[model samples]
Target chain A: MDPLEVEFLAEKETVKIIPNFSLDKIYLIGGDLGPFNPGLPVDVPVWLALNLKQRQKCRIVPPEWMEVEKLEEIPFSMGLTKLLLTHASDNIPKADEIRTLVKDIWDTRIAKLRLSADSFIREQEAHAKLDNLTLMEINTIRTFLLDSLNCMYKLRSNLQQGSSKGQFSNY
Target chain B: MSDALSDCGSDASHDGGQEDVMTPAELIEKLEEAWLNEKFSPELLSNRSEVVECVMEQLTHMEANLQRVKKGDAKASIHRMEIDRIRFVLSSYLRSRLQKIERFFPHVLEKEKSRGEGEPSLLSPEEFAFAKEYHANTETYLKAVALKRMPPNLQTVELLKAVPEPCLDSFVFLRVKEPQENILVEPETDDQREYVVDLEEGSQHLMRYRTISPLVSSGAVQLI
Candidate 1:
């Protein structure tokens, strides 16, 4: 239901993925899943895509030609993400709750970052401190913080509404 | 279209100019007329050259003012006219033309507004773009983690995006959980029996607190 489109690399078309959390499946927006590794190298990509759809009813479409350059080089966090997905499966309520909680928590963190940025900008305006930072730098920090918080807020709303297909947690 | 040109020419006469010294405004009108007529004329080229000079001078003036401001000397306030002029020159000409067209077609602007308002989360363009990007990157991060068999690390993640919300300084405290006292009282026994009551103690207080930041604005002001 959420209008966001998830783009990922796939073998044929650049698949637009949508997640169907209620059904525990991901419908390839324009296509479907292809052959991939079974181990940690490809689990998160598959599980994350599938679980996100199941929990949010959205899909994650791979971009074109998204091959694993090196199987051994995969990051550990992706595997951890898959583990969380596995643990939370079948308990849709818990999974959805955690997804919401993760996003809400991330939103709070972003708000804090924004507050820090605002303080920094105010100090710059008041004391005119550009000791180590350019005015643009300070402005950039402020912009980034605000942008992050706003983004998290959108995701939070989307998750709460159960229409966040193709949309990911802002965290 | 013929009538439109005559009207434009009459309007152009309001401004003071030499026989060929048309202002940028007149040049714009003439260019529009020419485009409508689908005729290429040598005069259009000359007119465009003059407009370019006016635009160049405007930008030079702004650059000088910015230099002064950057050096802590804010003597001159860059006026809006000069700013518009500079912008016209710097950005592609099509942008200005599109703006003019949009002005003529007011419904386009209204449609854009309606689309945004229709969304459940009324996020600004910048906010939506950043959020989408963050989601993508987060997925990328997850994929990276899975590939490497490494533990999830939040430190590498960059939370902020290029455009921040405007009202980011406001914050509110949220009570996540509240304490409640329970009293269990025993009621009457059956038929011909008497009634009795029992009471039990409950928690004095129990609650959890969370700081809620409003989604309406940035709500991220800091004191630095």
Candidate 2:
């Protein structure tokens, strides 16, 4: 299988189209497509829609997520993974602008998350000092702190190693 | 060969082809620029093959020049490494294009069939042939697997039933570009042909992805 196929399968997005011509039911290796009518809106795979658009047989409707206002309305709690999986489309004409917006949102949300997590852990630690913390609660916080610390350490070491390599490569 | 000599000698002539005679560093810079530009722009798809061909030609010339330099020279090794890096990028770039061709093989085949005989494929001939063979093999394998699993009584059933349908049930947001009436099948109301919603020129709404696809191709609203 081609790498792009794998990528598409992993991250599929549907495309909207308005056919300019009518057609009977067409069968494809993957599946069957519509008994299309001219001027009626139909949704199809992005690849198929692109092919039809290229042939001048259909008009493509831009996805709603492409709108800047809608994108801004996406809540921080949606998480980056969900946002990336659903919103990212190669066909988007303003992808760079969207990507920058996404990055900014992700950075802001992550900072907020980190702040909350830190305070929650600190509050738990304080409660534990007074013997108010449960064993399960202690374990959860312990795991979170360990994971975060390990990640930070790894990132720091990688940065240091990269700089050292750059300095020595000149020689 | 004489061709290779002429390819190299043309660089020294003061025609407008300064690129042909560029130094190793300059050549590497040019290659890097081309690669980055290709990476960033979707419009470069048609021109990619020629860009790659030019890079390969320059790389060949670079390798020939390196052969005359001392093996122990640091500059020679560095240039060789740069060539290797460029070569890797070129291969990956080609592979990405091939992937797109393969993914859209059915559409490509349909277009090709409609075109005149002896017309060129978007992909290189070798890649197109490979895609065709791969598709054929997959179909055969799927049929064989389906036959093996069928019950004796249903053995005569067509294999088409066993073929999985491409999943097309994802919802997407769409911005309405043109004002048009649509027959909406909302649960609250019966299928209504009356303009359910007046699609203002720049209004945005979350709708079934297929509903607005045609507008996108017609340069209605651009995907963000």
Candidate 3:
């Protein structure tokens, strides 16, 4: 069965959540989606059971505590991609193209982070330079990084999968 | 007064049923369920708030009756009296809550309407500040009040569009800033509209309104 589409309706905003296909119904209910309630904000700590349809499986990942990486050191490539895709700004004249380019840069950045430990260290040092900024502004910067990086990674992954078509490989 | 009450009990159900043993919270829960099922009658609200008092007293009476039964009073008449007492209490409370239930929807609707049309908001800036204050206060409050059940920022605001200049001369509104998210509106002589908006971004059903100002009436109850 296809994944059950879960829509979050809050105020006038609508957000559709897509969980990984392997997540189970029980896990979905017990995890973030089930624990999501209207009376409380998203950050509340509550144990709740979810009741997702049987088409998908779910798993619960505990909060990961890291000593080496402070909030500042964590990469923003994923969030940046989402923002570039969704957020529109009048100030950034070439926002779309710049976002695309930023995303490509991040893809290379992530590959460096994932494949070589030194790349991750270098990125952390770069982000640390923006320490004087407020948390919100820092988050925006990180989000920008995530958006570009993720897009590039996905493009690369797609190209690799489609490489079987010999004539189209160069393109 | 006690003798006058005993006669009312004699005329009601004579068996101690399952409802006789339920607590006040449980009874309200049952009434809530009844309201959902559309099984409630118009007579539900006829008794007013007395219904809640009566139900609470009835539950107390039944508990007393159970004690009597345990002490070796198994007489059929005694058991019947217990049942009758509970039934009357349940019916009375159910009716009262149900009666107010209708009033609740209208009151909320009226408040929303009045909020839309009523006075220019002098409270906008204060309200915004209060939201932030509430967030900070809630952070402290939640440490003591159990964060799992209570949110760190629970602010309710009554928002109205800026009033036009023509209406300002005749209207008077007072806005009092309180600690955290609480704002107190002074006793308003003219018509007043208050709306409670829940600012939690993740929640769907976050806004509600009521005409009877808790400050003017019985005071508002905060749920954490």
Candidate 4:
């Protein structure tokens, strides 16, 4: 993984911290940490926060997304769509609600991606008709279309299967 | 009802002999758990191929089972959807693995080359060949464009701009867990090696990665 991507993931994961003692600002190669003050809550990356919590230097506040109420409202919160799809937490209080919310979010994202992919593919096809589609453009569109179509098929199947399982279990 | 009960019975029985067979749902659940737990460490490189192959085999079985169900059956449709989901996850996992390998391709290749023996690569044969070709092309281009113009005395290239530098030499913020004494080796002097730094527990510092890599791996320190 790229260090940038690692940093991005860490940045996205917020953790609340309460420092135990006062400390001078510690400079790191990446950046400075803090002139940490005791008894004050501060938000930091999960990695840094977790380390502090482990050392008994700070108390950690979990991310808001992990809250059950927030998770339950996820399906309705179309504007709140910055959730990382890959960060699956096993110990969430409401597993079913979270699962459904994640599925809904995945479906929404995939739908948007498919829409863009379809237009791009169509444009590429039209360009190809005029022999104006460059090799790079063709390859890019091909991969995008393939991935979008694959995701679409998967989502469709999941939706169908979920409904069918409900009906089957009722019988 | 009997068929559903029979399927449940088979699933229950399979718990005792898990190596024999697994239901599609169980397989999917397993794959999802595995995907969730995957940390993309270097040690997991070999295991990833095996896991992918196992998932692919189960998917093939699931596909066959799906086909056997009557057309328009809801259960069958669900199975079809599950298969697609599994495929998507598998593909994404493979792609991420590929990206990691590609990012570290030059470093991996050099390590393998220095061993003086051909070893298995995390990438497929085609990808490996492509990386080799790409590196070769980049080196030739760099030589032609920049290196060739430089005076012969100053043309000594320390490292290729195209290849990624080793991350082990980079400084990182590390939190120490266990106290230990470490000898600090100054790069400039071979004679002045009396400097000893004491690593204190619960303290964090930005230090050379090589100085802390062993401690990190041994759980004596953690990278922040």
Model 4 chain A weakest lDDT span, ten residues long: A125-134
lDDT of 3 by residue, A1-171 (tens): 001100110011212222333221221101223233322323211111111112222222212211113222553323322332343222234446655655565556555434433342333211111212222222333333433433343454456575421111100
- Rate residue B177 of model 1 by lDDT: 20
lDDT of 3 by residue, B1-224 (tens): 12123332332222222232343334433333333222212111111222244444645664565665545432323334434534543564454443333333233223334654543321224333443454456446645666545453633222112111111111111111121232322222223343332222111110111211221111121110
Encode model 4's per-residue lDDT on B1-224: one tens digit a residue: 11122333343333223344444444444444334323322222322343455566666755767678789863454345445656766875666555554565566456545644444444555556765876677568778888889999866454334444433333334455687776362331233343446677866554445565556544565544
Candidate that beats the other on lDDT, 3 or 4, i.e. the better one: 4
lDDT of 1 by residue, A10-108 (tens): 111222344332222222211123323222112223334453445453434332222233212331122222333444344333445544544454455
Q: Which scores higher on DockQ, 3 or 4?
A: 4
Task: Note the Cα lDDT for every prediction shown.
Answer: 0.31, 0.46, 0.29, 0.47
Q: Could you tell me the TM-score of chain A in candidate 2?
A: 0.43
Better of 2 and 3 by lDDT: 2
CAPRI level of candidate 1: incorrect
lDDT of 2 by residue, B1-224 (tens): 11222443344333223445444334333334334332322221222343455566767766788789886763454356446656765776666556544544454445555767654334556666866786677667755978557777755543223322211111222344465554242221133232344455655443322344444434353321
Off by over 4 Å in 2: A1-171, B1-47, B116-120, B147-224
Taking all chains together, each candidate's TM-score versus the true structure is: 0.18, 0.33, 0.18, 0.35
Label model 4 with its docking quality class: incorrect
DockQ-superior candidate, 1 or 4:
4
